[model samples]
Target: MRRNHTRTPLIEAIERHRSIHPISFHVPGHKNGLLVGDHPFYQGDLTELSGLDDLHDSHEAIREAEKLLGDVYGSLESHFLVNGSTVGNIAAILASCETGNIVFVQRNCHKSVLNGIRLAKAVPVFIETEWDDAGTALGIRLDAVKEAMKAFPQVKACVLTYPTYYGYTYNLKEIIDECHKHEVICIIDEAHGAHFTLGSPFPESAMEYGADMVVHSAHKMLPAMTMGSYLHIGSKRVDAHKVKEYLTMLQSSSPSYPIMASLDYARSYVGTFIKEDLDQTLEGIRELINGIERIHPQLIVQQADDPLKLIMRLEGRTGYALQELLESVGVYPELADPNQVLLILPLVKKGLSFPYTEAIGRINKALENEPMVEVIPMEGISTSRRTTPFSTLALSLEEMDGKVEALISLDDAEGEVSAGMVTPYPPGIPLLVPGERITADVIRRLNEYIVNKANIQGHHRLADHCVYVYR
Candidate 1:
């Protein structure tokens, strides 16, 4: 028999408990919003108590909710992640790999994936990612993974990021099949692809391709609170017990009740989404896009494989300047990179309305009020840097374990091994990874980012033109 798609076990449990209006004495110390005062949602903020299942143990409502989640995603076992996809990525790596094990990683993966590799004490062999004309890094080609498997036949696991940050997807099924053929456990960080299960037009999810494990940030594409994510164990190859243990160790003991409830709600939201809902949402998007195009003939709006993401750019203006102009009119985009600004449209349903007309008017006003400044050409910055099909760290983890660090001029540090990660925000791909050798090309890219004033994340002294290196 088919399970009821409309039921939300965890959320229902929370509401049942909230209706009682029981007295406080709980750990939260908020006293049921008595102290917070005037915050509407604070009264629902709860913790582990009778009738409310513990996140780690999960015997009642949470367990039932997770079962519903598994039913929706076709996973053998599914779990709610309260610490965002970062914890899911780490737990997946820990469950699949042991210390000193060889793991395949996509070079353009998020920093959290790299941190997971570091924590697992696994050696990473990074497969190069292909880039588009707009300088956005895309998924690794199947041939590249095959070549890596041929070279590193003893690889224990492979972690990949499906649907690039810009929402581009490639042949993920073949890549997962190749990993399975080599007896490598496949773990996917599908942070931006939680809605792929909606089917049609949207690219297929990694889980559908039989990935051993897949992590999804429900908050990214679904109607969930921030930090609410899901981790699915799809195959028997991985140790489910180990995944649970790591999650128990990594996640906060007192998880937020609201976030978990939202996870349950998000799952039901997707499961119950109908064709009418999709049609309405797409129509709203179409109107928004058409109105924005009317603002200027030169404006470029590029749609990706994922219909929800929109990329806007204009000639002679940097994405940063466009982002600023949009913000001036109270319209902020998801993020802005050197090449373009990304917009994340809401996934609405029937009877719901988005203020598309108001947004278009604000966008037009922003453009008319602030004239765009021509961006200076970044000469000598090589957008297409040649990278090997597969490469390893310049310095072994053991070798860099206790190495002394020294601050040196970035221009003079080309040959030195980096002691930190230097990543550009928005996309969050690291230009330099810890234990990787700094090259002249890396320095040039860093300089380009510095000149463009893109937000740089992680450790670095780019303002002083210095970086930490293993001395």
Candidate 2:
């Protein structure tokens, strides 16, 4: 049975504390925004005071807030995450698996997953999820999980990113069921799927799929601020006590109270209005997209794309070119790379008018101004992605030593052990990760991104400096 979604203990606690208007000699030097002088934060800025409750301990308002969060997400327990889903991933992986256990991981997992594995000192058996087996699009097929499990029965746990950066999800309940059949713990990074539970029309949340544990970035799809994430435990098999301990270890000793309050308010707001608002909003966006398709036949909408995320494949231009054109026309996108542009939407599009008509008009105007440029998808690629056997750079606890060297150029990158991760910003998915031998195809992909001027972040400076290689 679903519990009450109305109570917002954390927000209420903050409001009460702020309402009392108590003078401060607390740890925060801001003194409830007084120091900042006229800044917006002064109202909600607070510390762990009487009735406010500590996040690490979570006895009063924090506990109650988590309960309300659990009720909204259908979790056995929920912990407010101030450190983003990164800490949630770290703590969840550490808490669930014993050190030295082999974990089945999705190859397309965010960099944080690798960090979690390293922190836990867990061995990884990477599961492949390439698009059309061409190594561009990424998602795990159900059969892939079955095959990996049949191959590695000794694997103690499995972690996957559901609703990937592009907002793609598989039949997750079936996957969880399969994980249970193998007695493997299942952890889901539902960081982008926070809005799934707002209504039935959206994809089913992992919480409902009975994943042993799942993490959500409330800020991603919901109205909460960035880093307002939550870690939810679903199955009784998980050691909640251990999960709590790891959370304390990984999360900050003093968390931002305002972020926690936003989480509380966002949950209450979503639980109350998301379903009805979303239903109407989706209808309007659908109508707008239909019109957009009719007008711009060259811009193809992805088949597996989310309603909130508009992933477009341009006919003549690469994703970078399309992004440039869109920006020229004032249609700001969330993220764009070589082949695609992802546009995240604000909710209630149909119910309330968002500038879709204006945005589309601008896109058409920009397309008219741009010179034609033909680009092939994955062009000039010479190699394919190697399935992880995760590199010693990742698996071993030893610091990067004499074995780690820098290659100043991409020409010599291939076949060298990668000592660093190269990830696209905004989405934070890795194009190159530690421990894998850099392949020719990866080199080509990196060049394409560089040519397109997309931002790639990692230890190696691909644009100018050396590629970190583990010998």
Candidate 3:
């Protein structure tokens, strides 16, 4: 029997309850939008009362909604995450690896991956990621994975980021197959790829490639609320019960009803996405691109593997400057790095309209305005792309926990282990992880990033030309 993709069990249940206009005796002080001045959103801000099910121990509406989610993704089990992909990543790692286990990690994974390893007390073998001339960090190559597995035959699990923040994807199927050959659990942080399952123009999902587990930030590409995400058990290789246990422990007991409902709606939105919708979305994106290029012939628009993503850049101008210019004219981009600004185009169904002309007009205005910041000298820096195929932390997270740390200049910090993770915002790939050694190459890259006016995140006083290092 075919499952009805149109059915939103959780939302229907919430609606059924809302239709009753029940009394306000629940834990939420808002009392079903009564005290909140009928803000529309508060109407669905419910708790685990009556028909609304408990997230941690889902047996009613949430269970049915998750079942529908699993059907859509073709996973053994699927879950709604209100805490974002961060918790999903952590829970998946916790469920897969044991203390002191060797885990292979793509070097450019989000800091959350490293945090998961730390919390699990697992050791990570960082596989160096490849980069393009444009400085976009492409995902780990298959050869790198083979090399790491050859070096560490006892690897217990592998965690990878698919379709990087810039929306670049490589041969993920081959990589996942290799991990399976070695009986290593494969987990993918497909935060930017929740729309992949819609097929055709979109890249295939990691779940389709037989990953043991996969996490998605539905809000990234879908119409879900912020912090809404999904975790899928793609294969039986991972302990589904354990994954659920970790999710229960890691997620909030009091989950947001609105976020959960949005997750349900997001899944259904894609689940029912037909050929007409896909064609419509692709056409809109195509028109948007054409308009952007037609108006600003100087802007270099680079489309990634995912059609929904585009990178816009101008020679001699840092992405930071471009980002500011766009924001000043009321046209905001997803994020800006040193080299380019990333735009996540809308994934609209048929009959829906996005203001593409207005957006292009705004872009024209923004680009025509005076430069937001003085163009920093666009000096070429060493790409710092190559490292040993496999590297390890100089000290484990536990070892670094109680150690004394000091702030020092990046130039002088060479040979010291980093006390914190220093990352560029938006892309959020760590320049220096908590226990990684500070090399001269790392210092050079840091200096270039600072000079380019990139927004550096995590622990660092880059404005003062210093970073925290373990004493």
lDDT of each: 0.88, 0.78, 0.89
In terms of lDDT, the poorest run of 10 residues in model 1 is: 373-382
Query: How do the residues 209-247 of candidate 1 rate in per-residue lDDT, one tens digit apiece?
Result: 999999999999999999999999999998999999999
Model 1, runs deviating above 4 Å: 369-383
Query: Tens digit of lDDT per residue, candidate 3, span 254-308?
Result: 9999999999999999999999998889888988889888555458898999999
Clashes of each: 0, 3, 0
lDDT of 2 by residue, 296-329 (tens): 5567775344567777767777777778878886
Q: How accurate is candidate 3 locally (lDDT)?
A: 0.89
Q: What is the TM-score of each candidate against the true structure?
A: 0.96, 0.91, 0.95
Model 3: residues with Cα > 4 Å off, grouped in runs: 369-382, 451-454
Which residue pairs show backbone clashes in model 1? none
Q: Rank the candidates by TM-score, best first.
A: 1, 3, 2
Give the lDDT of residue 233 in candidate 1: 96
